[model samples]
Target: MVESESTTKVNVLMVGTGEYTTGYVGGGAADSDKGAGVVALTMFDLRRRNKVSRVGMCGVNGKKFAGIRSHMQKNIGDVYNDMDLTCETFPEDTVVDPLAYEVAAKAFYPGDVAIIFTPDDTHFAIAMNCIQRGMHVMVTKPIVQTLADHQKLAALAHENNVLVGVEVHKRLDPFYADARDRARSNLGDFQYMYAYMSQPKHQLETFKAWAGKSSDISYYLNSHHVDWSEWTLAGMARPVRVTATGSSGVAQSRSMNTEDSITLTVQWENLNDQKTLGCAVYTSSWAAPKSDVHSQQRFFYMGSSGEINVDQAHRGCTVATDAAGFASVNPLFMKYTPTNGMFSGQGSYGVRSFENFIDACCAVNAGTAQPRDFDDGSLATVHTTMQGTAILEAGRMSLDMDGRPMDIQYDGNDHEPIAIVPHVFTG
Candidate 1:
């Protein structure tokens, strides 16, 4: 008799302890959308369902674990029945160690998994540590700041034979999934795409530490839409040049030397027909005023045959309260409300993203699947997501180089980016 892959329970270690991992930042629950968080809560519930085991969480400051545990106890455990939120903390409760993630990674076995939700600049180092240890990794968006680092991680993951996935949950959204499918099927050759995503200005304070110094709004927010656009036009079209512009008054006023908003215009050349080209504009900002929704996200796609529009933020759902006032909610991304007193958000695309990675890790561990099997554009693996990184790095370079256009050079075979250089005018 053979052991079933379904019966293989993989252990998980969550890296970083900010809002996305624990919903506890600066000693209390975050003021943003992920109050109960998406990562730890899902891990806790997955443990309850026996899908995973021995879940642990790691962060830079070990003292914050007390507050994080209390926050989870109140928001997640108290709300859902049979929810067990038990996990080991790294660097001991009394010690503060910046490199605690390495210690946590060492504790996990080779076949275990690690999900990284740290700041944008720290992703490559932490992910590299885990991958070298033979642990599968699922990193949050903007996987790395530079195309060079992105390529290095991809190469290392292949060398180590570990599954690596980028946590682009938007790819799992039902509406976005349908849109991608329709664009690939019904829509003709890609022509143009415009995408906008923004968060309220208050978020700047939440990320004040590294908002401008370590990263910018483009890498933090624009990565979402850029990846979607890349995923939509994969194999059919590839980005050739990128030009960017930014707005800077708001963040500078707050003493942060960063842009408040950024826009990137990318030129895409059709793979089959070099004569045909498409244009894409992606803009992101953290300076939006308070609105009914926390994040305002929408996109428009125009192809040779037809067009499609999506306003993902406002899905026609509104709620009014004297305490919080009238607001539009998106339960499709994450349904935090409990059903019958047990965790019922298993169907959420946000939840599905984590589950998909875990299942892939388990399958690989059971010898039923290989890491390369997920590179077929289904999961946002490192190999499939390099284009997004190229565009993002190019956008950053353009912003720094006085809005100069950057050129993306590809390998000509797989269409993956090989180098990014300034678009020098020869004529």
Candidate 2:
């Protein structure tokens, strides 16, 4: 810890006040576990532990701040002891400006942090501005839509000597982590992998704006497994080609102008042997029926010697209630229930992900850690997730070209790797 009192806590500026941050989705607080949202609640709890300094929030619509604050006060602050839901809001809560984040982002200095939970398309511009001003940033998944933008952000972050991370919290899952370790050790050469992740159809409304216009379901849900796959097999294999197919009519029927589901078949070249190859199928959708679990996630991996199977959705824990009906709960992600009337979610991976970033920021500010320190395949650093972006964008191009195969080209190998243009569809 820093001995100087002035440099003790890192200031934070939250860039979004929507579902993931406020849980006030579609006008009112969501009835799900995230009634008060994940990012805001975790930051508030971090401040209580003296890890964060000033906390501020920003949104495009200023009128919603009142409802957001009221919702949070009831769902979060009022529930936890001495939990204050007070923070600065950009645009003065009177002006409705789309560029309010630009104003809120100016309050933090170099070494401070900005946790961006905004839409996918807006991430590049906002994150660029923050990095230019020398502020550490942590953005939501599918960091950016294009590989060009991802590489640009990585370069800018490195030039500014700032920490930029993607919030891929699945790495914090013990089961997933164990699987990754085993894959590296016991699971011989990569052979085949199949992964699936989906959420209820209602999430379409949650992401209505950018559902089809800005990005697609592959970029939205498939990013988790793609990153997980890459993270698990980073040094063992590299993705070479990808062919994508999608099922439509469902989302188009709903007037969303997007695909109902997408499947990407990626070809991998094992690093050890030039001729040996591996294949992976990654499927994602936001149009599944409401099951006992809020999301259905599972994966099966096979190697030259052994194989592994993981069903992340069913954890052998189920609960039924009069109002909410029956559902399977996964408290490992976010333990919402308070202990002793105070926020006690330290063990949860969702909260731990934020805490890890905050602690890294503190360490960096204390002159004990460098940006490359986190590139050790632990956290989802910008550099480590470039290939995932490549695969997702390649899938998009494949869809635009009627399921044609696309190639993922890399400029360099592991040392300072640069992603070449993806989506080279020629069918």
Residue lDDT tens for model 1, 284-389? 9999999999999999999888999999999999999998899999888889989999889999898999999998988888888999999998799999998999
Cα lDDT tens digits for candidate 2, 1-427: 2132235678889998888898998789764556768999999988888998788998898888888888898889788997877799987777899898888876667788899988888999999998888888999998998989999999998898788999999999988888998999998999999999997888888788889999889998999999898899888888878899998886887799998899999998888846599999999998998888878999999999899998888878788999889988888888887898877878999999999999988887787888878999868999888889888888888888887788777655652335534454358
Clashing pairs in 2: none
- lDDT at 267, model 2: 92
Overall local distance difference test of candidate 1: 0.91
Once superposed on the true structure, which residue ranges of model 2 sit more than 4 Å away at CA? 1-6, 31-33, 415-427
* lDDT values, one for every candidate: 0.91, 0.85
The estimated TM-scores of all candidates read: 0.97, 0.95
* Model 1 quality (TM-score): 0.97
Best by lDDT: 1
Best by TM-score: 1
